[model samples]
Target: MVLNYPDGRLYSDDIPKKPAKQVRTTPPSKRTAQTQKKNNFANRGMRFEEAINESNAYYLSRNLAVIHKKPTPIQIVKVDYPRRSAAVIKEAYFKEASTTDYNGVYKGYYVDFEAKETKNKTSFPLKNFHQHQITHMNACRNQGGITFVLLWFSQLQRCFFMDSKTLDRHWQAQATAKKSIPLQVIEAESTEIFLGIAPRIPYLDALDHYIALKEQEHDN
Candidate 1:
């Protein structure tokens, strides 16, 4: 299953398994895949946040839901005056973000989620999650929000939309016995999302599918 960190970031293969050490030396200002481009939402490249942002855009355009990426909270520590009219941010550090990556309302249901990618073909590492994220997710769920994770298995090129209930159970296990959730377990608990060009991950529809299934079960 696609597991969520307490903070609500989704874990998938496509997200870097380990956080990259900020390349302190700023490289040339050429835009990477993270920036917005002029193409249609579907044409965006393989970057994780970009795909998710585009997916959110697709949902917004279609009137499916109103979701947005959480802004990275950074603290500016220093600046350089290049000219009277221009000042470059010379030094900055990010503040600890308090919420998950994305949240909004869909069909009168509150939605909160995180996105993650992984390189490991076998299993996702537990290190991707932190304690603060867990607390945030618990709050969201308790408030009746539909919370989940979007996992991209980058190497396998597979995606999964996993519910938060399954994730909370396993994440809690770390305190007692298991330190990491096994790959075999993830495969069993998660619904695999088929990746495509349009809407990229197309995960919200999967969310709709999930909600429908739950409703059917309730009817039965």
Candidate 2:
């Protein structure tokens, strides 16, 4: 019953406005072994996006909460019908993303977070986040739900759950301060998560930690 927009098209009585992202067109070609190897290592088993989708499914199946990936907003310019039932999409263009990647409900809380992976060893570049995403996270926080980002440091094989509040502070400080938030700073302020088997990112455990920490703070 709850309709949420992933890329920031707010639900309304009128049709949502699409983004301005360009769509890339690639001719059908054979993939080489070298390309396959690179993709395999980068993806590992299932892609990070797929893993998160599966994790969301796991969460949903048990009635924990409803979470879904927003479809890439695209405007179909052309389509061909081979049969009455089969329609081929020939041309489409991508729309802009005005918000973070994933969002949904958990234990009455509306959770919003973006999952980003980087090969860099030392710091997470500030450019990875869009300004609108920061604004979205801030709005979610104001709505009293949990808003944060999950950063996957691929080279180090480590992940961290950082509160959006801190990220906002650093994001706004870019003009005067350093452009990127270093690994050391993230290591100190965020919940460092160990990538695991069953749950992949095991973010719920980190969520538990965040909840507990918040509760303790509220108590004090």
Candidate 3:
């Protein structure tokens, strides 16, 4: 008896048993996963870090500001040198940050600040900040720098430019029952930053408003 398989194979039972389809056995690569995440971010909107960077670039190109993101300090414990030109960092740990995320000169004024994003809808958690950062901001303030924080409420798609001194005041009160800064307080004290197409964050505009308000307060 002879039989013809559905595939192009002629068979007695199956000529040789048609070879099984080769299925992909390889796992998805880490790079591929990272690329997917980046694509998702782009589709939704630029992430806080990316937005700030674009804004900083815009400022620099126009000679409006000279701000740059601070590179995190890393202590390398091990390095593999396959070649002098290629040294792979095998083991590394981040050192504690001594200052904020960004610092530079803006319109002849020293500008120093940290940028943070939160997923909370109503209040910003106190844990996102550190005592050392507060101290660093205080030191910068003492040096007559314009020190503040660029706070992003991701859930609400809202951004605020909060002065470091005001942040420190609330931070100190965290030892009491209050665990977070309410949205109302932030709205009252901080300058809201409307997202822009060119600069993205447009934080400098809020900074200008803050400066004017402070100057007015001083006058009063």
Q: TM-score for each prediction? A: 0.73, 0.77, 0.77
Question: Relative to the true structure, how large is the alpha-carbon lDDT of every model?
Answer: 0.70, 0.74, 0.77
Off by over 4 Å in 2: 1-46
Candidate with maximal lDDT: 3
On lDDT, the stronger of 1 and 3 is: 3
Measured with C-alpha atoms, the lDDT of residue 93 in candidate 3 is 50
Give the per-residue Cα lDDT of candidate 3 at 74: 64
Query: Candidate 1's residue-wise lDDT over 20-94, tens digit each?
Result: 342332343653333222121212223666778888898899898899977766678798887667888877654
Model 3 Cα RMSD, 1 decimal? 17.0
- Compared with the true structure, model 2 gives a TM-score of 0.77
lDDT ranking from best to worst?
3, 2, 1
Best by TM-score: 2
Q: Which ten residues in a row have the lowest lDDT in candidate 3?
A: 10-19
User: What would you estimate as the lDDT of candidate 3?
Assistant: 0.77
- lDDT tens per residue, model 3, 94-122: 45666787899987789999877677899
